[model samples]
Target: MSSVLLFFQGLEHSPLSVGLRASEWMYPLVNTLHILGIALLVGPILILDWRVLHRRATPPVAALATVLLPVARGGFGLAVVAGSLLFITRPLDYAFNTLFQIKLVCIGLALLNIALLHWSKAWGLAIKDNQFSQSVRLACGLSLVFWLLVLALGRLVGYR
Candidate 1:
């Protein structure tokens, strides 16, 4: 783990990373964009997740999935790009932060959970049966928990 952290510390000192560090405005601007990307990604996602949770009145799960999936993908894309820019600026600190690692793990799990939900091949059956399955609800519940934790850990990176 020490060696791995050293590697990230090395990355933080790279020419590009140094340039970002050297520029006062660049880092903050990029971070702001990264946060904006998160908003783009998480906001619509909660709505779809709400459908599964029975929190809000919306179209059926299958129909809502069709609409919100694209928006979530766009948000994920933006967050990835902006996050990359923000990450290199302080790789070492993030590499060692316990919460940061947890955040990363949660992100991986969140993505995996969504992929599994999509690949489950149950949506069509549930739709045809005119019922919502508990599996879908479970995935949405997990996604909600994981993403909320991710948000908290991300904020903790600054304080911890």
Candidate 2:
């Protein structure tokens, strides 16, 4: 246990980690950016998901994705960067937190789902005809579920 603790002690005591811990203002600022990233990433995603689920009737999926995926990617950039900074402040907490682990797994599942969707024929159908197969609908449903779980687990990390 001491050896495991020692491993994180090195990370927690890093210069940047120490600085982040010491800065009263920066921590909250970075957290705010993380939330902003989540918003940017999830907002468009929800909109797209709504369309997939027949909850909306506006832009086609491919057109909407063309506009939104890049935005989500940009938000993902902000999230990973700020999240890394925040995680560095207390690596042990994140490393051990069950919810934190769950959140990471959910994020990975969501990414994998999207990758699989892109590789399927539904992607071409969506781009060409704005319609997709049942598999894509299932993927979209899973995407929504996984992302929502990630959000919940992310918030839960703070409780522990």
Candidate 3:
């Protein structure tokens, strides 16, 4: 058999592939869950970042972070699970899709942005003082942009 067919055949025998194929509605269900998770994850992050940028009625940064971080983490977990299932349904296609690759890269950048915010002493001091500095503002803007890119790229996966 051709390599592509062999790869797909291998995927078909995997547990995730079997699960994805076992139910006609499974892929749709997983896709829905993935969307829900993305919404949950992005919504609070956007709101918090906007507050940081606009400086209007901003909550204490620590308080906002505390409130949103857990929710975002939960959503991340759900998204990962559902996304993995969705990917397993057509692993070869997903792996080769430009949109999917872009989405992955965007996700990595977003995660890196978050890590930088967490690790930066300036960010820590700003949060402690309830002030959003220029650096923090830039991070917030980049986070929003990258995440939106991720969302758009994720949607484009099906088309591409």
Candidate 4:
């Protein structure tokens, strides 16, 4: 307990500590970029999921993956960079914040969901044939939920 308390104290006193003492606009700028990256990441995933769910379009699964995967990856990469900077500005508070922990867990779950979708033969079939099975639909739904939660949890960092 003492060690943890000391760690937090050190973090609070660190020259890079985030708070009113930090440059006024820097934190918000980083946060804005992080949000934009999240928007980019979620947009394609949502669209692809909707298409798979509704059977509206029939683009080849691999083709769809090719188009969206890079966008999603780029967004993720940007978000990670921005988010790390944000954390660096206030490592101690963020490290202890429950909302931040939840956000990280949600991110992990979202990544796992994406990996599973890519690895599953059914998901490939759905993409290639543009015909999603019940399982694929369920996966899509879960993916949506997980990503949304990640966003919500991120917001909660400010409120809680």
Best-performing candidate as measured by lDDT: 2
**Better by lDDT, candidate 4 or 3:** 3
Candidate 4, residues 1-160, lDDT tens digits: the string is 5887787777767776645247788778888898889888988788777667776766665677789879989999989988887776766778889889988998898899888888999887776667788888888888888888988888889786
Where does model 3 exceed 4 Å of error?
1-9
* Reference-based lDDT, residue 137, model 3: 93
Clashes of 3: 0
Candidate 3 on 65-138: residue-level lDDT in tens?
88998898888889988888888888888877888988999999999999999899978897788877799999
Per-residue lDDT tens digits for candidate 1, residues 59-155, read: 7766776777888889889888888887888887777678888989999999999888777876567544536688878888999988888888889
> Candidates' lDDT values, in order?
0.81, 0.87, 0.86, 0.81
Which portions of model 2 miss their true places by more than 4 Å? 1-5, 55-57
Q: Judged by lDDT against the true structure, how good is candidate 1?
A: 0.81
Query: Each prediction's TM-score against the native?
Result: 0.88, 0.92, 0.89, 0.83
Off by over 4 Å in 1: 1-6, 55-57, 127-130
Report how far residue 76 has shifted in candidate 1, in Å: 0.8
Worst 10 residues of 2 by lDDT: 53-62
